[model samples]
Target: MKMKVESVNLTDPSLLLRPEPVYDGKPVSAFRNFDDDENDPMKARVRKTYYDMHTNMSVDFVKAKMAKWLKFNHFKATMKEALIKLNDLVDESDPDIDLPNIVHAFQTAERIRDEHPDEDWFQLIGLIHDVGKVMAFYGEPQWCVVGDTFALGCKWGPSIVYGDDSFRDNPDTHNPKYNTKYGMYEPNCGLENLLMSWGHDEYLYRVLVHNKAKFPKKALHMIRYHSFYPWHAGGDYQHLLKEGDEEIKQAVLEFNKYDLYTKSAGIPDVEALWPYYESLIEKYIPGVLEW
Candidate 1:
């Protein structure tokens, strides 16, 4: 049977009530924390979804997984077309960051270049890292892509995207293996041994991996596991990693600074910056990129 996805408002109780962010190991709703000056008060009135971090994701783990499947460039269409499609991607639950979709994608990529002018490849990664997020805009649901990426073996962690209260309605949670922590998986299986949620993060990575030489081993690693905050930040999946996963973990940790810290603040003109990015595409990815 095809997987059944429930159409939910972006503000569905599940998303609003999530324990942490779906991609980074942080809060899903900064509702209460917004007023507190202690946790990043530089900006005012942060959108609640901005707090939606990936408690399950880590920058390092994302790097390792993305290196396995990296993309070379942004959407094949012109930036104008890409922006139209991105704008259509409104989250019913995540009403806070209501900017256009391309804006979000651009902010992430542009932030990288601003901080690390020396790392051209990483800047490239920022451009398209979340492009696959458009799948939801195309018709898929949040459950299919935006959530804690877990193994489908025997036991699943209790803190999945929805957690206990939210997953009460999910059929997958009932399956014996799906409910267990290591469901259908053995110890130290490593993320390579798993399949993640089908989203733009994975899709974009696959595109780059096939394109060849889009990003270095380290940057690719950041692309894949940057959303996997659970492993690196919480060390939840340490049980699934092997001895070989150590070094890459360290590299991903460093990359996280840029991904989260680099906001859409004080940036140059995106339209003007395209020429530089376009040149980088010619140098690294092909002039013709796969959608």
Candidate 2:
């Protein structure tokens, strides 16, 4: 059956009496911690996926990926239609919740909306944050499309999750050009010049820019680096920051709260929330867009 998108009325008195969405007060560490051996086999799957991502996502790999994906010829899709495609993506690299990816999208967006009600574009950014994972449905491996992203051309910092041992076998680890502290990039060159590990975050960021979506640069940063746990979460890669990197870093940090801490087993009424998001998508990214 086709998924139903229901419109909800927020001003209804009876609905107001219902409890707001529960947040459970979980710390970010409790969210994506994949080291728990006692956890389900899914954790093992997540571990292996990150291993592959860390090993193969070198600078050249990123450049090749950008060349292939940035062409924007994959397909044309409306924003909502592209987002709905995430229903089929179960990220093997995330140790967090295992529900349909779209549910996580709605959950993240709703949490942002709860606090920043007036920032509709920010809320819309939250909703479609992972929409580029649609590449998974198009036959890309989960390793390339999901998982935490990191700077590819530069040194893989020790702060990267599993960075110490996981990337040892990667060819770039020993390459003279790519193994240094500042591989292939200048000091304080800014993040825009860096080639990040190829993933949904970079893909979606490029998509928004390519389609000329009217989101703020801050929202674009949130989309681009939401998975760069090393920089935003682990405090690595500071040597490469340019003049205003601090402000963009702060924006990513703020968005991270809603993205990570708000994940819950509970699902959102996607249908009830669709109308509001549909309006936002129309305002920012209307009609079919190049992928």
Candidate 3:
């Protein structure tokens, strides 16, 4: 919640447990590989999800979604209630972890807790990072509610899952105002100035701020840009980034390891873990939130 800020010891040995991380037998580099393979059903499903997202997620579409969902009028539920809804969701965009999204949630949270036991806010951030996917239950498609996000108005980044071929059907690709290198933005505009495609990252970030959640600024940045792989993970958008944005990128990268690699980790006892996490939720984001 609103705890006093303490300097984190980045060199803590627990954080280095996985120097070359491997999950369930697959190496870390093997994860997030969006290669198209018709013979592999999981690969096909992942491909189709990104294709649908890149095809339909235009500047207008993102704006319309913001106008529709940002009102926080779709429904109201407590943080625990909202997270429980994820029990029924399976992200089609994910190449790993076919289990219910709730399993991944617990896995991420437990992993964060194990490594950063002192940082309750960081652990809570892991628990609820993907809770915005609850938008799926409220009539949004997985393409709009899940998956990696990119800047909507500029030229698509080279590192986005399927690259240019996937966005061929998107109308924004043909518009001069939105297809240029710096489309609708100035140089060194910084990550905050860019309009990202609609997804759970931005949605949940807004929800936390709108509801007055007291997590530190770094926690909010972790939630907001964790899905922005192209910029943080792929080295794109350097021209648009202002000075000090490197800290944001590093924060997202720090959070990303637990989010991405923990999908294949063993599932935690959600029932047993709830008492601890619920306390943190109560401290930070208690009560029914407008969604």
Top candidate, metric lDDT: 3
- lDDT per residue for candidate 1 within 1-291, as digits (tens), equals 112112211232323223346434334444212232334433222222222322223333344435533443334653234434665664322323445555655676776777778888777777655555655654554434443344444443433333343444444457675557676678888876765544455665666576565467877776676655446554556677888787777666666555443333334466876778777766776555555
C-alpha positional error of residue 58 in candidate 1 after TM-score superposition, expressed in Å: 22
lDDT of 1: 0.51
- Per-prediction TM-score, please? 0.66, 0.90, 0.92
lDDT (tens digit, per residue) of candidate 2 on 223-275: 99888877766667788888888888778877877777667877899999999
Using TM-score as the measure, the top candidate is: 3
The order by descending lDDT is 3, 2, 1
Could you tell me which residue pairs clash in candidate 3?
Answer: none
Better of 2 and 3 by TM-score: 3
